[model samples]
Structure formats: structure tokens, C-alpha cells
Target: MSEETVRSAKGRMGSFSFEGESAEGLLRIGEVTKSTGLTARTLRYWEEIGLISPIDHIENRERRYSGKVLERIDVIRRLQEVLGLSLAEVKAVLEQEDRLLEVVSRYRKDLDSGTRLVMLTEAKRANDEIVKRLDDRLSEIGRFRMERVERGQRIDSAIEQILREAND
Candidate 1:
């Protein structure tokens, strides 16, 4: 893809030209699905659930996603599949992360030590919540793994018994 910087009305560097199209690193639905291994219906459902959104392209009315949205999609996928978090849990974690970002931004702006302390405390609270959820999921996975291992051992013992009987 060709790269060209385009500035927004606010004089901020926003979009890049991809294939002669001046969109904000915007990609078509098909391209996103192909790259992310997600279906179009899944993307739509995510959008409906306030998880992710497509940019408004009034020209063709087609759904386009920016590069940042693509990264967010990856994050959502990892939270769900890797961390074994439900969609609701993922949403909660995402919201907490956003809150943490807000707190950090405010902390940067305010020079007062007391106010900074409050912001840091809030950030810690949000981080703790996220860590707690992850810990819970990890515990569940551990239990599941132990159960499977025990079952495998029992199966192996039964097979050994059957072999011994056949030899006798």
C-alpha cells in the first residue's frame, strides 16, 4: 500500500493514502475480515454491542475500519480467546482500560501532588479490577487442566488393567 499523509481540519495528521484512496488508514470490511480471521457478521455484532465501530464514509456508505480499530479488534480477540473472558467481561476490562487512560491523562495535566495521588489511586483501582478478573479466569483454567490430567491418568490405568488381563 502507498503511504501519503493527509491532515484533518484540525491540522492534525490523520489519514494516509492507500491504493490512491485518502482515508484514515481505513480498510474495507473484507480486508479486515481476511486479515483478522473474523466474519463480517461478527464485526457487525461487535459494533452493535458497542465493542467496535466502523468509520462513516458517506461516499459509498460502506463500512471502513481504521488501523487503530484493527488493533482494538486484536485486543478484544486476545481477551476473549487467550484470557477466556466472556464478551461482557471483555467490555468491562476495555472500559476499565479507558478509565485508566483518562486518569493518566489527567495526572499528566495536574501538577498538584494531592490531585495526582487521587488519579494514581483511581488508576490502581481500575488496574486491580482487571487483574482480579484475569486471576479468576486463570484459576478456572487451572482447575480444568487438572481435571483433564486426572482423567487421562485414569484412562491409562484402565488400559493397563485390560492389557494385564489379556496377558494372563
Candidate 2:
């Protein structure tokens, strides 16, 4: 059986089917770009780069995003705007985050308990990697912010001294 067929047997066939929301609430690329504040070209490029899964395409070749996947997009946006991570870093972080879902969906209780244990262990490892990456990124951001603050203060002090000298 094909991967899609096997996934369908497990009740989902795609990456975005969380809490049953992917079955409905789909948005076209236009709507997604508008709502996510991303350009259409950027979205397409991200998909092309494997940074994001390409959103669904219909018979006419227009693409629609799974609304459930909007949450994932938010994470991408935050990583882009806030953390300033490179595309490669963002992809690595996202892959780790998405790994648990992919692993857990493979579980079948009817199979040996050992299989379930393996899946659970894999999930934990993925979660740990995600957490570690996030923590490191946060610390890096903190240092960046402090450097910016120091620069601003220096600029302000220099301007204030010029004004004081001019008044005297």
C-alpha cells in the first residue's frame, strides 16, 4: 500500500489535519497570504524550499492552505521576524517540532507494546530537540536585544552631550 493510502487508513492523509480542522476551514493562497502577512511569492518559495509543505492544489491549479496549518505558519513568522534565524535554522527547528506528530500518527495499539514504546521514545527525543533549539534561540535573541539597547543609549547620550555643549 502507498503512504497516502496507509495514512488514510489511520484517518488522515496530510500534515495539517489537526483536531479535524484540515477537513474544513481551508483558505486559498490569496487569503492565506493576506492573513499571514506573507507575500504569495514568499509562500511559494518556502514551500519550494521544503521549509513549508506546499498547501493543497486543486484541479484548476490554485493552492489552498489548511487553516489548521496557520498555527504552523505563525511559528514560521515568529522565527523569521523575532528570532531572525536563517532559513536553514528555521527549517531545522520546524522539522523537530513537526516530528512528534509524524511519529505519533504511526502508532497502532494493536501492534506490540514495544512499538508504541519506541514511538513514544521518539516523540520525547523530538520534543527535547525542539526545546533545546528554542532555548538557544531565545538566549541569542536576548543578547541581540541587549546590544541594540546599548547602542541606542550611547547614541542618546552623545546627542544629549552635544545639546549641553551648544547651550553653554
Cα lDDT listed for each candidate: 0.79, 0.74
Candidate with maximal TM-score: 1
Candidate 2 residues lying further than 4 Å off, grouped into runs, are 1-24, 58-60, 108-111, 145-168
Point out where model 1 deviates above 4 Å: 1-23, 28-31, 55-60
- The superposed Cα distance between candidate 2 and the true structure at residue 117, in angstroms, equals 1.6
What local lDDT does model 1 show for residue 115?
100
Error (Å) of candidate 2 at residue 162 is 10
Q: What TM-score would you give candidate 2 relative to the actual structure?
A: 0.66
Model 2 per-residue lDDT tens digits across residues 1-168 = 234333442353334543344534556576667667789999889888887664556567667566545677888888878788888888998888778878877875337788888898999999999888879999988998999999999999999999999999
Supply candidate 2's per-residue lDDT for 143: 92
lDDT of 2 at 145: 90
The digit string of per-residue lDDT tens for model 1 on 2-30 reads 23211221133245444454575577776
